[model samples]
Target: MKIYITSLLALLFSLVLNAQNLEKYEEMPEVDGVYITQNMFELLSKIDVESDDPEEQNFVELIKNLKGIKVLTTTNVEVGSQMKTDVNSYVSSENLSELMRVKKEGKFLKFYSKPGSTDQKVSQLFMFMIDEDTSEKRFVVLSIIGDIDLSEIGQMAGELKGVPGAEELKNIKDEK
Candidate 1:
């Protein structure tokens, strides 16, 4: 009985580890939107660093330690709703802790993070959103992985303002 229980536990652990692979999300079917990998982030960072603007300079610094970013979005009602369900399940299965949530104007947003080495940082940040209205449905999922400072999240969101669904992030007021 002991050996059987131990074997089962090992299998469960391995399954959980495998389920966390980034490819799983990238390969998700039928949803159409942006999907950015670390290589693309490096290229984008380098390009932004060439700009003379101070804000762009700050973005260069913030993205220096980033490992990867994945964004998925869809506007089709059926596809969008399904993708929302899929993303929520994936996030929950990975055991990421909820960090923030906002609901307004027929839209809902939730943020999650996996802890980093220090209490003030996170290794991964995930955002999920659903926008529902009479005529259209939209959903988005953003996954950012790296040594992310909790205080710098707003800056990161600012950098990503052009991304679909990120415009709402601009409304996040600093509580301090």
Candidate 2:
């Protein structure tokens, strides 16, 4: 009984330590974070669209499979550095594979993914980016959890306005 209690305590401790890396930033005053839950996706998926466009239809289907999306952005140099470290650790611990890296218009973006049902699909899409164009450097991390179809990711990105690094998602399809 003592051994069982000890093991349970250790498991709970580890779970807290390994909780979602960027989640902490959500409450920090220096960081701006947006978290969309699975329930939100389900509601979005149910919304009827009058358009007959295949692209719109595909976007709805893609939303149905999405679990959640979390985005964190910061302009504080110190906080940004910490965010970068946390994201690096998260990627390593999660065993996510590097999908691509891009440097454009003074912004550096790195994308990683966990494999899904097929080579073109991913269970999660993670992006870390730094913008060096302005006086204050900006850091952004975006995590999209779902059975994401690479071909339709651009539409989802477009739907999410004001999300840093979202535009970069469109390039993902081009990379494939």
Relative to the true structure, how large is the alpha-carbon lDDT of every model?
A: 0.69, 0.87
lDDT of 2: 0.87
- Candidate that would win on TM-score: 2
The runs of at least 3 residues in candidate 2 whose Cα sits more than 4 Å from the true structure, single-residue gaps closed, are: 1-15, 158-162
Q: In angstroms, give how far residue 69 of model 2 lies from its true place.
A: 0.7
CA-only RMSD, every prediction: 4.0, 2.6
> What is the TM-score (0 to 1) of candidate 1?
0.71
Q: 85, model 2: CA deviation in Å?
A: 1.0
lDDT of 2 by residue, 87-169 (tens): 89888877889989989999999999999988889999999999997788999988889999987997677776766777878
TM-score between candidate 2 and the true structure: 0.87
- Please give the distance, in angstroms, between residue 164's alpha carbon in candidate 1 and its true position after superposition: 3.4
Clashing residue pairs in candidate 1 are none
